[model samples]
Target chain A: MGQRLIARRQSLKYLGMLAGSVAGREFLAAWLPKSEKAEPIRPTESSYTPLFFEPEEFSAVEALTELIIPTDQSPGAKQAQVARYIDFLVSAASEYNPALQHEWTDGLQLLDRLSREKYQRSFHEISAREKQMLLEEMSLPEQDSGRTHPGYKFYRLLKEMTVEGFYTSQVGLIQVLEYKGLSALSEFPGCTHPEHQS
Target chain B: MGTHAAYDVIVVGSGAAGGIAAYVLTMKGLKVLCLEAGRMLDPSRDFFTHKFPYEWPYRGEGKPGQYGKLPQGMEWKIKEWTDHLYTIPAEDPYALAPGSKFTWTRLRAVGGRTNLWGRGCDRFGPLDFKPKSLQDGWGEDWPISYEDVEPYYDRVEQLIGVSGSSEEVYNTPSGKHLLPAFNPRCGEVLIRKGAVKLGIKVTPKPLAVLSRIYDNRPPCHYCGACNWGCDVGARYSSLDVLVPKLSRQKNFELRTNAPVHTILMDRSTGKARGVTYIDTRNGLEYEAYGKAVVLAASLVESIRILMNSRDREYPSGLANSSGTMGHYLMEHVAFNSIEGFFPQLAGRPTSNDDGPGESCLYIPRYNYGEKDRKYLRGWRFDFYTGCGMGPGPGARFPGFGSAYKKKIKELYPAAVQMGGYGEGLPFYWNYVEIDPGGLRDRFEIPQVRFHTTSEYDHAFAIRDEMYGQMEEILKASGAEIFPYEKESPYPLGSVTHEAGGCRMGNDSRTSVLDEWNRCHDVKNVLVVDAGCFVSHPEKQITHTIMALAYRASHHLAEEFRRGDV
Candidate 1:
């Protein structure tokens, strides 16, 4: 029965290959549409016109993103091209709910203003220590300060987006975590494996 | 229209539920009509070959600020571009009281939501079929037991070719599966190790996607094109397998783009005579006759269809004489869970080789058995190690130059992640009611008023516990935990495993459908979907929904032979 099944599968494969051969490249193209390709959101140039934010706002946004997902041994937020993705996402973000846009814009402006008051410097220019302190302070409850920081809302969006984008990325998912998908020779490493027990 | 095409069975909606129903009933030599609302998709052309979000006009992400096609907003958008066409818009006046948000995401296309589902298939154990007995005064027990539904589940596992291990089956029931089950990648192995150290039962998640060559379908290719649609036909979507076979049967006639208006019931006996539908193309109205009618148009749409068939017997609507047509709605309460970064698995190159099922691992419900909890029922966690590269949000990262690409390449496969996918128990107060005077959907019918779980504390508390448990497991796994900032909860109907509008029970007065999934007031009409679930299981909702469809279709076919209807 196994032999018969194998023979049947071989025949099916032969038939499939023959059909493919008969239906050449042009046939395949007409028959099957092409996949949509992922394009780089940022321009190739180092200094390009800011689409979503002014230079000042962009600098503050950069600092805020870094705080949410800091760089470690393997490049973190600064290296991921996430800022470009955000720029593209925001510039093209005319169709979103009003609450989301308001939250994001308000949050960024608030964070930058607070940074200027505390450090007498732009948010991006603040020391990493100062940045961390500011983040921690903003994360605190409003009852303690009697004023809720605008940067807190920006932090929320940055944190959520960072996790979502980072985890879904090819780099973050594969190189970092080692997720191996469908393997033809995939073996079931039973939880009871003595190695696992150890 | 012509001879009033007769059939032994008529299964509507060519989804996980309707497809299985057609395959089972037709294999028994019963003539079946499987009607779907969307176009028949050609897998080679329509599926994974080119399904990047970037491929669509919106790139799978809709316009910057536009409310998506369903009008519920873009955050809750279903995968397909056509999903925009099939789903009901939010502005259609689907009534919900203030602060009571309902996220009704239904796919009316050929394969339904199974095409873009999470591929997590689990058995709803005996505890789920009878939740009322376990807790009290919340919902009804299923007419069928876990034992009664056990054989059907086994048959389904065999037919769909599931990849799972029976040993991992704890409170989440298991069946005779195709293979032992695929294992977690190295990162998942570590997370599982940590979770187990915390006394959490982390096991291999059972997925509907093929691990090995089962039946005729190919094994998963590990392309991770599952959220869009798998063109290779490895995933468990009805279009890939069941509906295609059913279409080959001479008696089956599937009509796509046929938006069903109402189930035309006889005035004298309240029997389902036929269905009146409008062809979405020309806006022409046509009726198809069947000895029996099955409403498999999903939970939300099915409720809408029944509510539209207004008659004297069912003054509220057909099969709704009991005033329970659209009530006790339940949705799996979900959120983007606690995440953490671990440096242990860094430096590995990207491995985008696995399909949807291959990404990670599953931690079974460890809170079961003699455990005192803040909530009655329990929830499970899905763990996956992140690999591969994609752009991050600007708010989260920096750099627009080649430096960014170089960095992304370096960090592609080094992130380990886990999420808690919990089930919400049915609360009678959390239900769907129809607004007769509300503005209609695209179908021009009064929209369903959803008053389901919004302020339910038990469900919320259960979610909080899930967050705590997830953090414990991550800490055990030796990772720096990134805790959930807040309970960023999504609205009901967002999880897409939306169930429990027309719950099945022995009590005819309270429930719309009986144990066999037959409508109590209208014997000839069978309602099968997530809506028929007595209680939402700890696992995902597709397998149970498919199994219930089969059971109901089989019973309906048997009744047709017996001339019972």
Candidate 2:
């Protein structure tokens, strides 16, 4: 039985190596940087403070971004370094779009107030499934106040940023979906997939 | 003045054509001074290393009225449309009566629109240049034919590093391509299959974007932020190849933010003496003279400079003896089509992170031959497969809630659509006349009055036929069509692919410049831009424009050597 267990472990290890050789190596090569090269994400911190939200409320926003794009199959919002990006973007809010920054901050506080009234836990502490359910519930056009319910409007902003951040990131592009032709790929099949045929 | 300060040639606009002209001229042992109206922006400092559209000061757009177009929420994308290009405003924005709204987009910074352009480097065949003989009375023939430009085109394809296959039978001229053409992703492959099933000849197009390492430039990183600038020095922009090379030359001096106001002409001789321009930063005026002056400052601005000269010899304008200073403006009439929930995209996470919308395949003009069609001219079609579903004005129409998200996921992958890039006829009515009422920009400079797309009906008919062809492909693909309103605005120069403002011709009476783009009246002044294009060929004009600049400057050097200038 111990020998059988060791053999099983060996098989698993071989499979992992094979998988890594085929796809993981290319992915890791893209993910890992050489010593000479600079990191895609810069080290400078963002100047955009959470305008309407307190420190606690801003944490909820960060958590919410992660929840929407979880770090599972690929680098989610957190791994793609989206929070840093959002911070850099928000700090320069007065210059780009003031209303957008206000809406983002206000939405966080409103969501926290609504959450406190319902389940009694902070948004970040909530279960993943529960958070997803709440998001799904509030994502309605009727719930959007356009101005009054800032949280509802803020949810929309989060959605835009989540999708934008995910799709634009290297992990979301290559890992989630196979996007091979940065420079021409050797053997790209142009719309000839048998399953794709109408 | 001695030949101490001034160079043998003074080239305006450090964009694609101007950069190439400077490189060629400087390489030929002539000193060249290249002036750019915008600031000299470095890519490392100005572009990339930022996130979100709101990270920019102008929100990635240029300063208002800098483009001279009207202000609208939709126009915000005009700024993000290109990093180096400026959005030319439509102060006296002309409409196509009730139905037409055109987008004339331009880049005004260091590299110009080549930074934002799709990099679809298509060639003009013998038919496009000699259109008058091929299909007479529709449009005039190019002053020179494809054969004349063929050698230069081959040379440019080599220097710039064009990648593609040569199906020598098509309208696009075959060449000795530097690299093999890029193949489409799986989604694009599906579209190609559908097109083939529909009898559409869709092939991988020759693109300026590199597939392999060529000309010492790196291959594309596939970052997909192509409409923004390339940070990796992959795409063929002036910054990557031309300007950097030109900067290395001891004879070349490029000064940016100097907006040329007028051409300084010798009153008695009626010759172009120099140019008077305002420094955009300091707002101070400076005059720079040269033995020969080449105007590569686009179609409209190039002509506007000459008109503002207002010399005594030619009262109407400097080179107004032909009475064709600003005539025959043309833009590509892009007819777009969209459909949702493609079957192929179902349950698949596809990578939409590719280069800009420069398509892999092109549906060559089908109605070019002697066929019974309502439209006089033919239009080309290009298709793109996009990923990511957005919740905007079109969000509610598709559906709502979780189903919508699921539908979006399903639809995003399957979403492949085609658009018609139709040709606009060069009519005398659709022209740019100077604003006599003295309408000024935000910089308080006088704005140009462009009256374009007068022949909208003719242009629309051609577009409609192309749309019908798209419908046929969709049907052949067996994709379920989600219907939307076909209410696009008229060809209002929105794309900023502005051409034919100062047309080239053999006859000086009907055109602004001669075959060499030389002002018929002025011996030393040469215009090398869309201003010199008599007809707008089906292909993008940048390559042709650069080639012309090279040819024109080469001619100027030979002339100067022969004591002609």
Candidate 3:
């Protein structure tokens, strides 16, 4: 695929030379020299130290994100280091609004309290099955009776951030989701399905 | 204050209008100096196109609460992925009237907002030129007709390399394009058929992005990051296309980081001598002399400069003799959108759908000839698919774990959306003025306070009609549409198609600029941005802004030759 792209680019360069106006060719010479092939992205080992969450809270976050997107048929959130990304984001956000950091910290405490009440252990000490059950309960909508769970809103926020971090990561997009875009295409082959065209 | 080198013409704000004005004037052998408020950017170095989210600190999801603290002017800049293309909010600020809200999306770079534009280049038809007089009496008609600007449009379209297919729609005037149109996606093909079944005309969207290698610029590589700045110059931008060509000329000179404070006037002759500007780098003031001064500093910014140009002869403002300098503000008001999931394409594999940000299918103003509608003016519909590559509403799905991931994958390729860009009538109540309550920019110039009244009964009515049409089309396409009740029109100026602060007309009492975009009070000063728009059509205003700038500059050059100044 890389070789094909390079060949396509070279042909485009030839075509541009043939059809380009004198002024267009001049501007092209000035701007097109840096159009070299981009470097391939390699997975780097993360040396992230938790800035926002405590050590216990960071462990719970890692376990929770893994459960949310476990290593099933494809690589998941744990491989993407979603928890570390979330910590980095929240830590930087403290300068803009410290309330966000407080909310995250308090939410972690709430999860721990719920785990202690249900299974006589901290959230990080709980088993994966128990953690999944607790998360399921938290995902339940508020009933018509107006009774709400304690960690429901926090679950929603954590889930949103985890999804954002995971899907945007190289592991989730390139490996799990198989997102194939942002590359040079000679032409967009749009709408191959004939049935779609009535 | 030291005086800089003088030129025959000094064009302010090196955006679309200023760039085109400088290009046309300098091509005619007149010495020109272009003043830009922001610094220059090398797109290959500055644009974040094709960069993965992992490359960013927050993985493209900006830092939490960072957006909340940003000023209203910097809302668009809060996106960490493309923040480099925007101006710093603290350096340039504007105010809103009490109980009013407006989003003045601006870029202070050499290319202005062109660096971050959607690149949907559409032409205004004869009806759009005089919608009030021809169709309904919502506002004053443009003094110049479509025929007067048609030739200039042809020239500009060929120069910029617009890619589009001709259609039979009368409201959207056809132009000669340099390349053929982009092919429609599967979802767009479905929607086009549905639109055709409903007797709605769907034509190829005219885009400033290149289809073939027109000029020396390479064709689009389908990166889908046009808004982040086109690194390859596949899309049209003043910095890449116009400025570089003109900068090569010996007669042309460009001064970046020079924000014009006011248009300097010779009091005795009652003509614009040049301009006084601040060198933003060193905090020093300087003056550049010119025979003519063209103000293309955007709509609101240009008006702010004119309002700040207060003197003994023109106390209210430099061009405020009509007392209508900042009156009749307008923007495309109705932006109603609807999205749905198609079952047939639900599990289809994703390809290189990352073309230009613009879609292939465009539904022109269909209600132009209809007289029995609830609204006075009309709206255009743009159907698109695979335009958004990021996580969508699926990210907000209930629950988590592997089932959640499966649901997102299923819904990803099935997504399709249609949005409307409707016309807004110019109103006296929706105007901008220098804030008297003492809010100022970094340069200590008083910031503009915008006020938009709720005179949008017609706009709301058109939105309802748009929703009904969207529902019919989505239903016909065999898709499960999102609930219509949840959708609402965006606020005023949210579309960033604001116009009509310094409107052009034949009568000086009702307009700030004459028919040729020249100030009736200050003859040598011309406002060439969208500020000179008389009526805000639903179409994108950049094409008309460029065409009008070319037309006005042509006349200015002729007038100079004739010694009219």
TM-score of every candidate: 0.77, 0.75, 0.91
Rank list by lDDT: 3, 1, 2
For candidate 2, give the lDDT of residue B201: 75
Which stretches of model 1 miss by more than 4 angstroms? Answer: A1-91, A94-198, B1-5, B48-60, B68-93, B134-139, B346-360, B369-373, B388-414, B486-489
2 or 3: which has the higher lDDT?
3
Q: lDDT per residue, candidate 3, B512-545, as tens digits?
A: 9998999999899999999999998888889999
- lDDT agreement with native, every candidate: 0.62, 0.61, 0.75
How much is B321 displaced in model 2, in angstroms?
1.5
For candidate 1, lDDT tens digit of each residue in B253-358? 7889887778876676667877888777787788887778888888777887888887767778778767766777776767654544455543445454233444
Q: Deviation in angstroms for B112 in model 3?
A: 1.1
For model 3, the stretches where C-alpha displacement exceeds 4 angstroms are A1-49, A142-147, B1-5, B67-78, B88-91, B453-455, B484-488
TM-score for chain A as predicted in candidate 2? 0.57
lDDT string for model 2 (B320-368, tens) is: 7888777777776653344433564556655542443356666676555
**The 10-residue segment with the lowest total lDDT in model 3 chain B:** B387-396
Give lDDT tens digits, candidate 1, residues A1-198: 001001111111111111122223232233222321112221123565667777766655555555554554454454554555566667667555545556667777677678899998766677766766777667433112233555554554665555444434444444433444423333433233345334
